[model samples]
Target chain A: MAGLTDNANAGAGRTVISVDAMGSDRGPATVVAGIDRSARKNPDIGFILHGPRDELERLVERRKSLRDRCEIRHAPDVVSMEDKPSQVARNGKGTSMWSALESVREGEADVCVSCGNTGALMMLSVLRLRKLPGVNRPAIAVLWPARSEQEFNIMLDVGADIRADENDLLQYALMGASYARNGMEIAHPRVGLLNVGTEEHKGRAELKLAHDLIAENAENANFDFVGFVEGSDIPGDTADVIVTDGFTGNIAIKTGEGTAKLIGALLREAFKFSPLSRLAALLALTSLRRLNKRIDPRRVNGGVFLGLNGTVVKSHGSADATGVSAAVKLAFKLGRSSFSEKLAARVASAVRVPQDDETSADSNGTTK
Target chain B: MAGLTDNANAGAGRTVISVDAMGSDRGPATVVAGIDRSARKNPDIGFILHGPRDELERLVERRKSLRDRCEIRHAPDVVSMEDKPSQVARNGKGTSMWSALESVREGEADVCVSCGNTGALMMLSVLRLRKLPGVNRPAIAVLWPARSEQEFNIMLDVGADIRADENDLLQYALMGASYARNGMEIAHPRVGLLNVGTEEHKGRAELKLAHDLIAENAENANFDFVGFVEGSDIPGDTADVIVTDGFTGNIAIKTGEGTAKLIGALLREAFKFSPLSRLAALLALTSLRRLNKRIDPRRVNGGVFLGLNGTVVKSHGSADATGVSAAVKLAFKLGRSSFSEKLAARVASAVRVPQDDETSADSNGTTK
Candidate 1:
């Protein structure tokens, strides 16, 4: 356990992250600016930047702080937004995204961060790092800004795959709990199975089976299974880790984001309704700005890929410098904590006993 | 077609709706108040209120408009919120929910309105009214306030059943289109299958099959099939009707509602942050009020159960007079337009051709 955990930073004095400086909508300049911002704030963090050597050298040279703390890796190719995952998996050897994951795989960096295509990044990370021993399918866990004291809840399987059987959902619960324990520093995360309703008898059969299975092993898994929760609980403080299949999680996250965007647009429109409203908006600008900063997506801009041997944080493709800096900060935090090894140990220790299988099968039959 | 379509208000001076005056959190008083509000606006509407005759008569007598428009029924039993669907199906004969649905089944009313447990209401409706021919499952359609010119897009399978095969989703498209045409007055509605991604190749296998099936029959069904849509499209103008399985639709709608509520609360908190912000809030109160009214859930309070022989409008259990009145207005609109007959005709005509079975199987094989 010690060797595996220490492999990330080993004898290093500072945490190092490999960043994929390609496929971001804002280009590598924004990525460099973001790294500069993050480096200015966190002097203990270093970066192994992966991109075209000449372009990255010039970009890093513009910032004295980044130039002092960053290493450049020349990966001339990039995975485009339109690149198919299968194509990238087969022919993505020299791409920046692939190189970033390779650094993590080779233990040169603690973790990897990318603002590239999500599908391509996931595929490359899975291909390079491989899934954990007992993990059926990998999941992408995003920290959602919610009403909890921690201000965020870890929601998993956001878009790694569209399907999750009962067993897969149980794995999400264990993996998400490990993430919360390390990423958010929660001792015993309260895990909730996302469903249509909070009733024990509601939702799909798979969900019910997952619910029972999660409950049966919550004690052994070192987490509190809070039965089932509805969509409202995602933003509320009902759970620390909300687990579901990729399809529903993806839809729910997008829906919440879309609603937030809609409300923001409406707020602007409302403030500009008339001269008096415009004056009011000007007067309340400070309060509105504070509110906006508190709920900004950039503040929680990294999606951690779980159930893999190494860690990969996927930042928003169109993230600006501040958003990119936030993602970098997240990667640094996870790296310093050796999140990958802790997660791996947690998953490994959470072995489902054979007797539990008999009980799970019986519950499945009843639920079905 | 003519006979069935004209049966709603055939030779009658007014369209009558049967009301289940039970299981509402606010009790019969709110139901009577809602009826009074709707009756005041629409003189051509009548109601057969189901509940204890003495209690309903007393409540109706409080309002002169309701006294004239409502005819009280002697239903002594009310369906409790905790009643299971199976229990309701076995022995719900004397319940107000049963009586209200019976009115629609017996042709005494154009539609039925209830503020009871949604699951129980759907079960009773399906048992009493039966599914329309060719319809594999019934779905509940709700009007989602969106960025469209219509201001609301119809979304189906909000919480009917948790599962939907390819055939069931195609039926949702047809049923949702019919509801939009009659309820929103759209000549031809645009239908989109809700998926994790907008790409035709993304999302679940059944969704891909449903997409092809919907596309192949969009012309025949007199609607446009707009490939796949994400959760954002539910509140966008891209599609007039968003279709998905019950599980996803229910979660999305609840998630949207929860997000809206959270934002609304946060806006209030922001406004009351300081004395200056409080002043600004007061100054901009008018504009804020207008914005609130535009997005108020009470205005779009009804969920119309589709794919059944008779229409059942399910209002929020905790609805006040305004929300209940909005639901009543929806029921009246569907009743006036003979929505049930049009929906049945639409589903009956958009038949899945037998030869397409081979193509569907082959596509499923490849996609799966």
Candidate 2:
């Protein structure tokens, strides 16, 4: 207890990450271990672990690093993966996810991290933090491993809402660019609208409208609009930011993950096919490990809820310690960089000018 | 010249595949090489090669296998990759793609194979062959490499139309199941509707309606209905046929292809990182080759146009000889099985009953 106070004093200027520890598939132990891993590598990170106080305290007590740097918040109820978003939103008080979000809402923590049900977390986030001003629909932006120099591309609206109009998509482009700038340190992100094809005349009517809107705002928003991009461009070097409605974005990311996993499984099976191959696998261990590390989904586990008043990172529900750590690291990075404020400022400033222009056009009788 | 007569007589009872040779990214030479390869392995397959008379003749003449088993159709105009579907549909009378489809429409060829622009090819197909009876929309069903025992899963509406109503999705299920039965030799295909989540209560309104509709038809259709599959399940063993609108399906497939390609590139980079890795790669060459062969995009390189009056296989536009050969192989398989006739019968029979039931329900004042 004395050591905990001392650790809190030492972590006074560090970023405090609010974490929901009970809902992950692997349980609270993995979350505790993850924060411990993060705390070990980053002295500038502290945690407010939310779960059943007694159970979480014991888990944190076992880890010396976490015992010092972490504070347990008593949240008796848990938000299970099966909990409906609407149900959780209405009666989710005292739950770990709710308490974790409360810390961020009350300005006690910089960013919140959760491995809970995505829909529940999102619904709670919107209810607690609310949408940023001028954002019609908030987006969940995830970093996808790419061939770019940055090695990762930001894509948005991955399930916050299944629908997005022209304006909503434009907001995603702005928010995605901001995420790239703050999270990935890209000063001027190149954004692409995801479509079935790259051609100008292709895709649905709304996409074409969204494409134009995004392109119109690119110069003012300080990002490059690369026009229409296909799903293949999500992992390619074509864009630093990929924007789409949640339905398409969600399917694309899941499809990408499934394909990668299948390939990895097939690769392992190939190596174990015969005695010679097995020997080769041992000899090529370092190389294989490097490749695995490069493409491991755990390395990029967090999906940042963009266009919200406060930052919330939704870690993979099935994430293990490494995945959770990766998510916490992201939260810490975004918190240290003041990502939520910067994002708020960027979105407000960019979104205002477009509205002003549209209003003026309407007054001038030139609006479509 | 003498060999041509011998080839026609020898191929009298064989399946004559109409090929759009000029529209592919690799030109007629690759198409010639591909058909030659198919001809080498499959004696019962012949080609009505469509392209400029002199150019195709020169290419076909170079391949002894093709010269004996191929006939040239002079389609002077070529459908460029950039041509719009609307533009091509209106005035694409003399183009290689149109000429190729004409062969199928006139019953001169069993099926049509093209490495042309997907949108234009689909447009020309619908215009030339028309939609089958009771099919509101046609779908492009592709065989995706999967973890299933069949090593492939059928995913449909991959870009035929961007939108699919509840009924259209049902049509896709019926068509996709037929494809699996005829093409993959699956006696009882399990169909799944693609959604953001698997829960019955999840996804858009139409998907829910579709889920119920598909479930209702499962027993009579002779296929199991696995309701609501997510994008990850596309390549998983969860379902034999995953159904979705063209928009989501296109993005899923493209994203899968992109992710696989990225992984393949990264794997190659990993194996070439160091001297020891290079040495290990040499030792593991056979295993690596086996892995590559298993996941190779070229191995499963055709998108079959379902719900059309005649069979059409759209190969990858950039397909080389091997890829083109794969498409030809798929085309030949479907042709030999009288897949078009069976599919039309299956769809007509299944779709009619549902409509009749709906009409009866409407008359009984029990319709939703």
Candidate 3:
């Protein structure tokens, strides 16, 4: 993992992470605090923090651990949450988000982390690092807390693009599997196509086509195709990877989050209803804290952008210090493992077959 | 509300519910037990139980409360969970699901309740009772437990039709608002178009068009338009009615349910971890029970089919007695309110303007 780092500033055993210190809901101090936390825990990690130089300098100076580990890149402009992706793509030259992506593009960082507008970050990443060869649509893959042995499952296209045809879904399946393999270290990930039902005849026409395509490439792609899975299977043990179009994937994740939040709020209200319950809550505090740690959204905060030339982890814009640290941790892990290169190779190999067949048929009048 | 019942067998104050005693995961006995529970609580509720004569008769006989309140309708065939929607629509004549719908169609029951296959039941309902005027696509509206004052919010197109166009989404907004009004008694319900994000430009093209259409019809349809809402808004105070296509809605609801179940499992596991937690669990039993009742999926068990000629409530196939009783309660509420008729009237009024304008333009060449 150490040998894979090509960044000159990343010393002998260190992994350099590019971070946009602006655009997070909590501001640059929280981001610096987060990196400080990561720096305190891991000595081999370094940061290329992008933001207004003077502001970031003061913030970093206050955190002793980040003082030697962080280097600030002067990017005076900040991308607001409301910025349009197209506008950002066309004219986002001096922004912190743009500067952060440039570090990865220039091989000065193993991975990039940002808590900016998702659309803007995606737009900037695609514009700067570019899509991998043979990759049509890049997808955002998040690790969903699950009941599986691994404790999480990978779901993709969680809002990279609104629509995905058969080919795009096939790419998601491969990319998701690659993520599960590299990010989660699963030897052979089981991929499931998200549908209304597990039945063959269920859901849209494109889903049916995608089903066949995913199944056809599963073995070659080094994953087991679990056929169709419903929304329930996203957190279930049915598969390691759940693949779907951005529209459905985005809604499913947010719905899951909302439901969890609602239940958590209800549980708190329930415990506060009476004196006896409040006493019980005190006695159960430790158990509750343990459960909270296991399911805390902050613990699994990053949504990795797959099918990109460089690894980019998009942290929740509203993330706190813990959440930002979690995102940085995920970025560091992927960086150390050279996840982006492996993902590009996997996608290119899986998509190469049909193109090769077309070329062969065109040249020799024979199908492979 | 009591004066709305048109069923002849229904007592002067009774609302008659047609129930398919077959197709549920638990068999006829559980269905009988469920109706008996409802019968014991609501004296003004009656049932037209549909299933095989001998099996249903014996089951109904075991439940003393149901002896006088329930009337058996002989239908030997059963609609299994695996039955295809098209197959059932074409050749499901003597099935209990078919007979249950017949009672509603023939005005012998105010509302129909079924635990059959969702697709099959929807297909059969559309085939039997038919779609109401101006409804291009029918939807299934479910009451999702929320943090709102109403305690639950309504979400539509929850697997009635996998696809909904702009006009179809407009119809859903109308139907969902009507359901919230008639069923939940929420006057001027706020309706939101479910999307990947709350932003106007975040989702698919259809969503953008649907957003405009829903906003345009909000005043005429007698509902407040909250514009675009993310999946998080489904269980939120932002909107009383959430409108989306069946594909997205189906996944969202299932994902929500799955997440709730997972959290519930983890909470239980957390409580069972140590002896101290076990003691805490015992002390917190009442509070936990209160919390359970508030978020229990079974408590809000029915998914009401909207935009149809008659009201039909689809209970979860695996519903236990409590779940079934909850569904019956919902059906009774809609039945007593003449929800189907009110929904039809609401949809007709909202859609009439455009057609009237087109007609006037064709005849006299002037815009309204």
Candidate 4:
């Protein structure tokens, strides 16, 4: 509750965008470059870069052009990609990452953006920022370009939780669907569970159970649950929201990203191999960019840590300056957006008191 | 097993390649055409078309010049792609697929190839041909041409067993390495386990345990254990052989295939959008083919169900004339080659008997 109030300053104040300056490939420089680029682009947004000072000061002092527009908050720690997610929250004391997270939780910044270790962020945030009343485990949700007359697809739980039961998976779908409705503002977003196959008996027992539970129980009627989606369907403009567990989702995302980049590289090499092909490559560069934009990792940079009380955007820890910038921009937009608040509100409103079918077990029931 | 065996009289007294003449994409005509073309090109290898008399007769009649060189064997039943592997064996009765498999199994034919349903072929063959001793789970090994001295990379157990333990995964690496040694026939094959990261803590519990087990074990000394490989390394000429569980491997293969096609299509459409680009595309078709060949799925058509008591090749269920032809070619090479025999022989030779230390259980007391 206090955490919400702290971050709530985002609505009325200077709109301070919290930068997890401690994270990212090139660290402070990358985040700073992104902030500079974004600040130059958006006049209304103010940024507070969170990290230890010497580098931040050097960065700000070095980039004289950005000094007037940006400010740095000193946090002493930095979480490396290799750092264990579980251990980092404790170890990253006084570090920029910890402070940046604190800034958002403390309401010093309206939004928080991190291109840091995802597991660390989740572990830290879930404990620090706290989970929503009924939410047990949090899930990560991503937005992908789908088709015309539709915005993009929503994918969930990308390496958030290792093991999920049927209930956890369905809850993920509900959270993701609610995210689509509120975050992207898609009305009645079609929901689909990712499966090895469309056949009911195809995947593991967990998937089969999840499918049956979701479909049979009329679990969440807010969105149209659009059944199962095969791996191929992720790229295709079929389902608006795709849901899967951590392992499969992470692999799917990486495979898609790797495969796309590989093809692009091949195309580049192919076109350059011969003079005539070079000519074609030059001619086709524009069209290729358009295609690239559709699948551009940047356009889909901000992955929301769903089921949390507040919005937390986990940018790919290895994201470049531009990618991190996009993530910050998304968080700013999402912070103001009606997605999570509405989802939480709906969840809160739907379960006024404990029913015969209480989702939570024992006397430790949820928001109910 | 007998049902899947090739007819003795049919394949005997002949020096011909048994083609599973069925409804391969582009049909029997293309196969006859490819055979006609290859036969025209190479005088040594003759053709024995196996299918219904009417279709084979029509094909032979259509190519009058090849009628003298090619022979037709009649088998009425057709193995539909959807048919279960068990059903294929039971109902193989007189199908071309059955005839082809039986032909090879019975030693009447040098090798049998069919681009029919991969599962059915795998099931029939693994049941019939049998896995070699010490081969726990048979893997479908594929060799990818790499940009290195070895010139190719081996990926195994693409889609054999759904869930594999450390043993299965490690066996995949061993089988793949052996394949690199003898199938692709590259010596000192470097084996890498595909993972999210190269570190021990990168993958699942099984992967972690597998990594330690492989490192501590002496069997890996026979080949170079190159540690973990991410998806990006796949495009580069990294390791000689990469091993993964069948689920991830299958998904990755499909993802790679689909992404390549997607990118290729995008590049073409982009090129054709402009007049000059169109002209360039027309001239650079060869370069495109060269690129395609490098990532050609067909180049590695026959995926063997390795570790089986016998040899079984699972070709693409939807394979066309060329794909099926390649599968047959692969089967002939694998069946004739001493890859498995050498592996069995080596394992047996090195360890005279199953010493308790030779096959130690992992930390979980589960066999690695």
Candidate 5:
């Protein structure tokens, strides 16, 4: 056990990264390629790829140098994409994704990045790493697809916490603001609550209440409150931070994601329509490449599950090598940042110990 | 008042649409163009161009046939995009948008369309139309950008009814299903609850509970239960009908909207960047065109605010003449169909009598 674990700890000292080799669209090949590519980019980092030993061995056969820089930790079972997080966590003893998460939990890895069932990864991380004491829920804080000067909006509650109230939203605002300040390393991050309209009274009762709470909190709020933002602001970089409930935030983020894919599909078709359009597309080539790079989802691959005790980054489940590589780099940057521990402790201290809305554990917490 | 009202209802027999002659983006010219185009396309439908009579008349001077088809209703005030709904609704006497809505409320016109402040429009509509007796909330149901065999997915609570519960979600599901069935004229619309995952254990407690309610209701539920769908599914047509709380549904729809814009921008850049890429784009043009048609947001320009007593279709705020025309056509189709009356009655009847989940105007009812 010691020998095996030690081998897994080859990631020690160097920014040790544990990749869920079995996770994602292309599996270990992509993960391995990404890890190797990223390792080459940053010589200071090493990795432990968690998956079936035979598969990793086969993929790594020709990559001898990469093998030296990385080690494989055998995780016998593979948790599937469709498995229930709780069910998987409860029964998944040696699943690759599980072991990758366990590596971080046990301090064997400095950062854990996985392109697996995001919710499952989240559940496992919470069960193993423990939630920061005060924060009731961990949110999925993301970079709002903004175009404004403050392009780095840290929008939160993208489904990690479901029934968030005014206080929960405040925590979200604070956590997101902290991330903007620390993660993006922006100073005096500007925060806005995502509303239907710019008016304070424009949203639902909770949004109104949250608006008031946020407004009052903003007087003493850790970050700068830039008032409210609308859906259009998500991509406009209207503010450095945007906050909303997990349900709304999740929908908004995914909508952005799916839309991006849809547009890509559309543009390809648009160019094929007529020779004139074809000429126009050809003529506009230079500017288009820059635009493509600007919106490349792969460039910003890892989405952090904020308010956790440590760094737990989720890459796209269907990510290719570029996306996984970006996730690795992101995890590295976040793992070494003081924001994780500082914000975790601050959030723990800052969290208002309000009464739980409902004591009865939601039996219907899962979707059928 | 009687004389003015009589003049207003002069075209009652004609399919005259009251258009808010104000442009949300580049000002009134675009709106005028849109209305003129609508009047031209649907000769059977008349146009009530509501705005500054002078500006509208001035804009209408050139179009000989459009001048006759679209008569200006002469509204003095315009609703600013930034104004609060509560304030704006009260402050505006005969704002073009307000006046247009009034036409619908008064039944002076068959329908009205606005590319104005959606918040104000919703508020005014609810105030004027009054929600159905059993209806606690109204929702905006729109077509998703994803490709579907059904051609589109109906998503509700776009931005209205933000803080919704299980009952509200259930109503949304039923209404969305009905809209798909009647509005799109599909049969046995597949209803899906949008969530983080499809597993029974995946969404928020309310959704999980809703899923069970839907599944249970499924045994007797009016629509086909397609279970839970993720963000990706919205674009994939995973279900014919997708239901969620207003808050989430709004964000999801908007995210898709903004993201499509962002990606469109990216693809334009990609096709223009270099020579080889440009040629490749030319080759890929055919596929791109097919993709565009598949995801044309304008093709389904109007989003029906379901659960309303009448078909109230909201077009994209920046919709031009073609979009508004499409919306009018949609409203007419819905109005003519047994959709609104039948759907409302079905949903109202189909709703579980809230045994223990008495989420009605009365929630104090005892649980089983």
Candidate 6:
């Protein structure tokens, strides 16, 4: 991909977000309209939108606020959702995804946001920004609707990779804690290692080692390391940050989403069971709307990638303008706080424990 | 522990279920009461109740139905919920769990039911009944609430052990399919191997190997083997039997349970949010009751231990009379159908694919 030069005319204090305006299910028009929405709401933010120049310009021209706040970078190629990550990494030159991330690499944008393929996005980010010095693997952090007043708990390594060693888990703890502190403004986020049981001796060998390692560094990591937590604690108030390998984390997340949707459908069916029940549902419309708003998946649509040198926020592929705007808003917040830099530092500082030490003690046993 | 000896007095046509009448949170009274409830509804069923002779006799005397249907076997010890499996294995003699399972081993009962510590029950079951010949690992199967009119999907290895190789997974498929066929009465039930994705290339290495083995054995196993399934399919109707490693299966089950409870609580809070909404709640009470009954965990509370020489049903530790009765009902159904013999045949037939093939090929590659 041709590098989009940094915005030389922009003021030093201004924040510019790079957006990959292609590959989303809603198409480029919706992506541009979403940028328009964000731009209108916050005049202080600017964008370097990556896509075909004529197509993006037409959409941006439809909104005066977006045209004024956005600068288009022409990249003719697009990464389709079905494209394999390996295929994209090797031959994805001039694609909008590569260009958008390039802007971040070249210091043209403070953050990068895309509503494209998740695996492809992660691959691109790792290929472009690279893992932070001490980080062995990157992780994806998601916000789950939780029981606390905050209404959200952060879970990490959702699908970055299917594996995590003991040291990787410790790094996820520190990185997730840092994200929670910066993103959620929690002073000292409580971190829990997800396990089969709360008992110390339960689960696989690595979880045990990870449990001990997290506890050992809890003070320096600036988080409370709750010994162990079960899957039920994911949406509970027992922990603010839940850490697990991507494979288990991904399964838990999908299972939770599937269960929620099933219940919601069942609830709707119940409300429509009879004329009297329909009347009751009509009467409870306001309360039901309030409840729906609280549990809406679209409201928490972005999964931020951590452990990379740059911040990349991945919106749901099927996100509408509202969801796209939400992702943009998250990217803007992290950009303002320099979240990527802080996360890199947090991971690097926690890497003082040598990886060889694990091999020497032969404590590197895995669940497999 | 003294053997209760074979029940020479058992009627030729009756199905006997050994019941551990102690250790449940509701105590022996509830166990006897549950028996009374089942006896009133199921005339063909008889029970061999295990507990202290005096305490159980008093409870049984309260119900004339239970007095005639139950045979008391004095077991003065109980397995506490906190007892470790290893500890229980060595010194579990004279305990109600032990005697209840022993009844099955001795052919005094067709099946055994207990509402005690799960780990302890599993330990006792394995020690007394032993794994079926040709079976390498035992599994626990639970019925999940599903989209099918059947109202449930059977999932296995909920937490039997934290590991399963390709052969073990293939065994789970056959065992779980046999369960669905005999217990749920689904002829040629569809079996699915749970993974992170539906794509053939998407998950762990063992999953891929297991996938091939299941597909290869589907016809002989007497089930249609779907290629791959995600966590979402657990509640969907895509597959009748979902099989995975114990680690993933355990996490998914607990996550689903926790998510269901969380949503239920949130819905209640929503209904009580305001006076007007509270009025709506009162009007919707009947529909809500119907909805609650459909999703009630108590209605489907038993976890059937598979691959064992005898069928053992583990009810929830905190099960009340209703939950215990549900478990007893399941036990009765399985006992009446001679489920153990059918499952053992199914597993033994599938075991013709030798465990040594996997060891020689070293196809034990895991996702990690």
Candidate 1 vs 5: which has more lDDT: 1
lDDT of 2 by residue, B42-136 (tens): 88998888888888777777787776578888889999988988999999999999999998999989899999998899999999899999999
DockQ for every model comes to: 0.62, 0.84, 0.79, 0.36, 0.33, 0.66
iRMSD (1 decimal) for each model = 1.0, 0.6, 0.6, 2.8, 4.4, 0.9
State candidate 1's DockQ.
0.62
Flag regions of model 6 displaced more than 4 Å: A1-12, A354-368, B1-11, B354-368
What is candidate 5's local distance difference test score? 0.72
Instruction: Tell me what TM-score chain A of model 2 achieves.
Output: 0.93
Measured by TM-score, how close is model 3 to the native structure?
0.92
Better structure of 4 and 5 per lDDT = 5
TM-score for the first chain of model 1?
A: 0.92
| Docking category of candidate 5 | acceptable
Share of real contacts kept by model 5?
0.51
A83: Cα error in model 3, Å: 3.1
How would the docking of model 1 be graded? medium
Candidate 4 local lDDT, A160-269, one digit each (tens): 87567787787787788777766667777777788756767766788888886566433333567667777666655567788887766766666566666655666678
Alpha carbon lDDT of residue A295, candidate 4?
63
Full-model lDDT for every candidate: 0.86, 0.88, 0.88, 0.66, 0.72, 0.85
Error of 5 at A307 (Å): 3.0
Q: Report iRMS (Å) of candidate 5.
A: 4.4
**In order, how many clashes per candidate?**
0, 0, 0, 19, 31, 1
Q: Write the per-residue lDDT of candidate 5 for residues B1-368, one digit (tens) a residue.
A: 22322144336455666678773665678777766666566666666778887777777776655644566777889887777789976887678887887776776666667778777888877877677656788888888765677667888877787677787887787778778877787777788898876778766778887887676554333578889888877877668888888767776776677767666665656666677767766766665667666777777888676666555667777776667667767765665564657876767665545343334325432221
For candidate 2, give the docking quality class from DockQ. Answer: high
lDDT of 3 by residue, B191-223 (tens): 999988887877889889989877767766668
In terms of docking quality, model 3 is medium
Better of 4 and 5 by DockQ: 4
lDDT of 2 by residue, A260-344 (tens): 8899899899999999999899989999999989877799999999888899999998999999999999999999999999989
